[model samples]
Target: MKLLSEVEPEVKVSVKRIDGGLEVKGNLEELGISEGTELTVVATEPVHVHAGPISLRVAGKETVVARGWADKVYVERGGATVPLLRLEAGEKGTVGTIEGGKVFEDFFALLGIEKGKEIEFLRHLPDDTLVLKIDDHEISMGEGQASKLMAEHGGKNIQVNYLGENEKAKISKIIGGTSLKEKFEQMGVVEGKEITLVRKETPAPSPKRGTYVLAKLGEQLVTIGRGLAEKVWVE
Candidate 1:
């Protein structure tokens, strides 16, 4: 077995043993690193590893070991690991682990992304942006954020935005803040609720204007701005 810091880039490895005591082992475990776990070394300088479905890096460190803390992680090469951002269009993966702390985890959970969920890589846009199909939503994210996710590839899903007038769909997720979520929730826009597109008005001839969409939620008819409509994911 070799220390994780010594593993060459692109090598697939499995955790053999962690030589650290309770504190270190506990911390590593929180990041999804432990004996029998498989991962891949994605980078050497400022070491980064794809552990399970999460991508981790030694922040501010030139190597994987920080003050010898991570050196205790001994590994043997041979296992599968892939970062979500590396997946090509038409490919898919199941979320395994999330690399950050509670706050980051909670943030993503609110967005309907969590461990065991499957995501489909849609396509890449200009300027390091990419689209991912999560549930029935097409979410656009930056490359940096995508790099933090790791997954087991091979799944499929379709996501869309526009809907024909009078078309109905079931809400899957809402991407917005607490107030926005609360506002939508009060109008019966919560996940699993069916909504119907009543009417859509094209944007006015103004640089600072947006399209307007009328939707029916339960017994109520709500007028949603273009920006808010895009954040409401549905099937």
Candidate 2:
């Protein structure tokens, strides 16, 4: 066991309640963390564990958690932290607290994506479309149009490149006159929607033409041009 702030780098610690609050022992102090700081355990394998406020990443090197408030400590697995919705499956957790509620908790609610929500991943279709199953329903998006909606999950900085012929796309955009700040909401793009990327062409130089995303829009795959895709940011 280690103190609340003396844990070694990448050492995953189980959180437990003590004295009406929470406490973590063992090398916790090394990270400048205290008894009540919210920590997101970034990794829990091969002698690695860390807790922090922002996104945590585990790798061959020591695990690191972004420095910040402590509360509702999250547990991680593999190199990627488990989705906050799935953290209830772990043990040996280190307890902590957050001031404005749990970051992970709020993220799912805001996005309308939850752990129990079912999603399907599809690849390599005869029609060159990207298809997915959500809530037991089958949905398909043209490959050209898939990338735009998929970009919503690009927050981890993931990029996609692929295009198909005969696919028509529409630039996903928010109506300029509308007060809504999100294009996804304005365009009716949400979790469980089938989307795909049908093409990747470099239309610019130097910095390079950004990727274009196409998505299936209820029986029609609409191409989302580069400009609109860039404007529709996702976490």
lDDT of each: 0.39, 0.29
User: What shift in Å separates residue 56 of candidate 2 from its native position after superposition?
Assistant: 10
What value does the lDDT take at residue 64 in candidate 2?
A: 15
Q: What TM-score number comes out for model 1?
A: 0.26
- lDDT digits (tens) for residues 1-235 of candidate 1: 6666555555666767765465445445433555775666444331122111222222221111111111112212123345444444555566555544565456455434556666554443222333443345444533322232322222311111233444455555554346546644554446555544444333233343444333322322222234322332221
lDDT of 2: 0.29
Q: Which ten residues in a row have the lowest lDDT in candidate 2?
A: 44-53
Alpha-carbon deviation at 185 in model 1, angstroms: 24
Alpha carbon deviation, residue 47, candidate 1 (Å): 19
In model 1, residue pairs whose N, Cα or C atoms come closer than 3 Å (at least 3 residues apart or on different chains), thus clashing, are 53-150
Cand. 2 TM to true fold:
0.19
Best by TM-score: 1
In model 2, which regions exceed 4 Å deviation? 1-101, 104-182, 207-235
